[model samples]
Target: MSAPSRPADWDPRASQVLADPIAAYDHMRRTCPVAHSDYLHHSVFRHADVMGIVLDHHTYGNAASRHLSVPNGMDPPEHTAWRRMIEPYFDGARVAAFAPACREIAAALVGALPQQAPVELMSALAHPFAVQVQCAFMGWPQALHQPLLQWVQARNAATLSADPRALAAVATGFDSTIRHLLQERRDAGNAAPDDITTALLRETIHGRPLAEEEIVSILRNWTVGELGSIASSVGIIAWYLAAHPALQSRLRRKPTLLRAANDEILRIHAPLTCNRRVPTRDVTLGGRHIAAGERLTLVWAAANRDEAVFGDPDECRLDRDPALNLLYGAGIHACPGAALARLELEAVIAALLAATASIEPAGSRPTPAVYPAGGHRQVELLLRPAAGS
Candidate 1:
């Protein structure tokens, strides 16, 4: 792939960008909609540009990663087969069946929070909720919770470092852990507990059983989405509510709106930052020529908040069209696990609101997470208990 001759438009790792990534991305959207940088290669910031890329998968391919990524990394016929196979795992029936367990977990976590006292929401509620709910969904033991949490932290650290060796090591470790779980299910035979993990063992593609590597890859992707993105989303939602008391009270009184409200809040402040795509042929985007085979980063954080698409990106309005929200993305690779994610987010947020009379920011200012992660890293809040309960 030929590198762009134009000088770097902005440093993604600059001190200012790291300190406030959302504001930095907003600035980039206005100044350099299509930016070239050594780190991301080329980034598409505007909504229209990103939509064009995702929709034209033939021109912009999803198979940008060096490693196998199941449906997320596959293109066309191959992606079609894998995507068809995985979609049913999160179909309405399965998500509905898991709702009771999800609510139970969410309520228990909320009940445990200290009333009328300062709490670090991420550690106290967000991370643990993500880990516990994920473990419950996969039928993994509670023992894996702490280990999985640690692994997520390590993975994020390695990603930020941009060290290939560290990335490889983290990948290998996660693969090993997943392979062990698969082996245990195989050993149990019909005696194995019925769960998503076991269900994947029985899945086949093109009339053949899924390869061990494929199974591991699927689980790895699901785990990352569940643990990392879900955790970040929880923090973001809670922080937003605490900062906006009127919206918080409105949501508390009318719980049915939580679904759309959660989607809009996450749209304003994205959880997953970007997804990768590579051009199959040379293409012009945002008046910039991107060479064939060059990498493209679709900045969801910037694109969803583009002024041309959503007026006043920061405004929390529920009337806006849902199709325009890029929170879960669009086109073929649009997050297959979106249904499950929505169910999980709504359950947790509903539980939090039902249990607390009000959620207010504490003394310490919340710390925003840097690149490779979205939302606040540390959010201190005071959760006041509801009357008589």
Candidate 2:
């Protein structure tokens, strides 16, 4: 292909798609599922198209960014090695063991919030819920929350060119933190209940102990992926529940609803819009030819809303089959921490619902989620006590 052809009318760089992208995703799925963008270097929007590339790892190599996602961007054998090193950290048993800690963190954070109304859900709830759990998992000190939060916020801002300096600060802090963690773990001989840091320090890569650079990449991926994605996702869930008080009450009444609620949230508000892939060679998908080195956008948000795969694609019904949701992503790059993320979300939601009588919109600041993804990210709300609730 000489140059990727974009749909004539749409401007991929426009902010509206990043403001409330579901409409755009809906449009793309129906009109140009296998569409390309002249500016975007050939993006893929349909569910099947993205899935084909994601599942067939050989044809579409990952390795997009070397620093943060390490193996998330790599292909098979190399990918498999890194994946194996961290797999034990995300296993069923690992999640099972983490349940208690997750619940404790949730209950503590929820219980500690002042009874004052109009709490900014980001600072008061979502941020804490995500950070505390991550800290607990990594065996890091809770005192690190403030600076860590700042670093993460700065990093996200940098990604959007919202704040270049902020991004630099985040990187510096992150690098320092990684160095400290590695040194601390090494000094302690890296014994663990089996978290990623512990697993890495003890394990070897390619028959050699992992170097500092490799370890830094692993930590960078963890911090970047966890901080924004989890925080943004938590805010999304809370905003949804806060709007639908009935659903909030339902979760409060039945703790078991936590898991399904998580699934529903993932389907409803997929925060990560499009993940990129580089075509290995000439490949035809949905009548579109993808040449080598062309960038393909895997519209995860679009796929979840696909009418062919999901009925009432625009609705947020919690009763849908959880397995069908592609919110975490698909194929090799599908989230390994999805189980852990769900557990954390479930615990926090259950606790918040159980404690508050009802959630009301105190106030929510409107900010667009990242693209080729969109939605409101910051939502402020009041958790009013339900009568006899």
Candidate 3:
């Protein structure tokens, strides 16, 4: 056996790719489904190939990160155990319980939007809504919202920079913030509120109590998912609707169709771009031979928009099979918080549509986000509130 050659198929961080990742990924899926680069190492862009990697965990390991990531970065049976414990949090009962709070948060934000004027949706609505919902869900103090938002920005910057030292520092900062909250709950003891954070304190693994680090890791993952994907998703869905008046009008009229409509819109413009996986054994995919131990980046943004699977990648059809969309990913490592994410997104979008008569792009065009981040950096829209209430 010989080691496969590592050639630069394309520069993932190139200016053109960063400028518009959705278009860049579309090109990659067609031209080089499986390409190699120094930055991402091996990038997988096709639908079927990515499905194969995620489904078969034995050949594709999830322990890509050196730090602990609970179930997300862990392989079974460890991953399985963590996943089981975490699933209950997003169970039907819990999700239903939080629906009222989520809707209230969404409604309040939408109501505050400037009517018939230019407003940056990300800052005014998306980011605040994301952080507020997360904080409410976890029973965290409202005071943490600003700090949490700041942390998300710093973490995203560190990831994009690809500086190992900077990434570590950012991780430590997040851990510290989480640790303080945990300590506060501990200090309060019986007086602490019976919330999710407090509930985690009572959980155990394999007959032993979970370590402080483990609890922090679990919450960190949830925080990142809520803050990043949920916020980005809001921007993408709103931006798409603003651009397409017909679809926007359709969702507003139907209202019940917001969930499927959201999934379809995000499919067209992904909120989270990629996820990492390492090969436990040598494998050949999409006509490219990848060596064992080499890192592979599953370009979800590309896979979800694959022409082979979606017919026309750009077309938005709510009736398309939901199984094909990789917005929350697939297989064992699929997003555990997907239910909660859907609830949050649906609440926000529904509120926006209900509160607004129309939403259209305002002043300058949206500034697209770069690698490691999807959706827009800044999305400005002029909103018109619905008649009466």
Candidate 4:
């Protein structure tokens, strides 16, 4: 089959787009909802179009990567099996049980913040919170925090470089880390610490225990999903609140609104920019025809902010329908860790609010993260502790 016979719509890696993804995507959605590019082939920008593709997984397959991606890279049946095993880990009881640790981590980080001083939120709080929560959840030690953080940054760099060698090295590096942890559990046998990592070792598929490769894939997926997204989300949330003191004050006064506010803020400035897909057959989408085997990128940053659906993409409203928000995505492939993610985010924001009387932007603007990653690279904010705390 031949590729589309059209000039590229726009470059995704353009300097302007990387500088401000939301604005760039807003333009693409209006100008070319279904657009083509060298980097991201056919890009879908409308909410309706993205939802259509997401729901019809048969036509738009999830096997976009050359490497194994556990359930994420698999379709139904295969995906269904892995998902069933995975969902139990993030069930209501488990998520509820994990809340205290999450809150404790958040509170400790907040306590350590310098009182009423300009601090880089990404390094000072965001990254640490993500690392600690992930470690606590998987029952890993505190020593692994910095290594895991470094891994995430390197992985992001490899992805942006689009160099196969670089990307392969990053994947191998992560597998080594996870493999070592897995071996520790194996060495312990019956006395394996009792945590998520150990629980995964006990899981079986089709009456046989999962292979080392499968376990590595599963853990890799979880680590990537949790580490990068959570940290980016933290930075985005703090940046938003710092820029909008009125909304910050309101959320602080009404603690229950943190969940809704967090979702809204992320939707406005997505922490994860896009997810990939490939066509199983030749099909037309958003007025553009894509050939079979062609790659497609779902621009969540654009779709979530699509004006047709949200009226104003930038408007943060607590009353919007939760079903419409694609922050964790939609359909069969929706994020399994979504419940835990929400709990951690809400817990952190609530703790920060409770501890601080005000969170305002430090004089300088933040450095926005580039493609393949979302949110600010370094968000500076002045945090004032509550009186007598």
RMSD of each: 1.6, 3.0, 1.9, 1.6
Which is the better candidate, 1 or 3, if ranked by TM-score? Answer: 1
Q: Model 1 — which ten-residue stretch has the worst lDDT?
A: 363-372
Q: Write the per-residue lDDT of candidate 4 for residues 1-389, one digit (tens) a residue.
A: 99446798899988898777788899999989999988888899999999999999999999999898898999888898989888999899999999999999999998899977889888888888999999999999999999987887787677767788998898789899999999999999999998999989999987899999999999988887898899999999998998998899899788889999999999999999999989899999977778898999998988999888999788899999999999999999999999999999998888889898999888777777878788888888999889888
TM-score winner, 1 or 2: 1
Q: Give all candidates' CA lDDT scores.
A: 0.91, 0.74, 0.90, 0.90
Which runs in model 1 stand beyond 4 Å of their true positions?
1-6, 157-164
Q: Per-candidate TM vs. native?
A: 0.97, 0.89, 0.96, 0.96
**Candidate maximizing lDDT:** 1
- In model 2, residue pairs whose N, Cα or C atoms come closer than 3 Å (at least 3 residues apart or on different chains), thus clashing, are 62-73, 63-73, 63-74, 357-386, 364-380
**Candidate 4: segments with Cα more than 4 A from true spot:** 1-6, 156-164
Q: Candidate 3: give the clashing pairs.
A: none
- Cα lDDT of model 2 by residue, 326-360, tens digit: 77776777788888888887888778777777777
Candidate 3 global TM-score: 0.96
lDDT of 4 at 140: 93
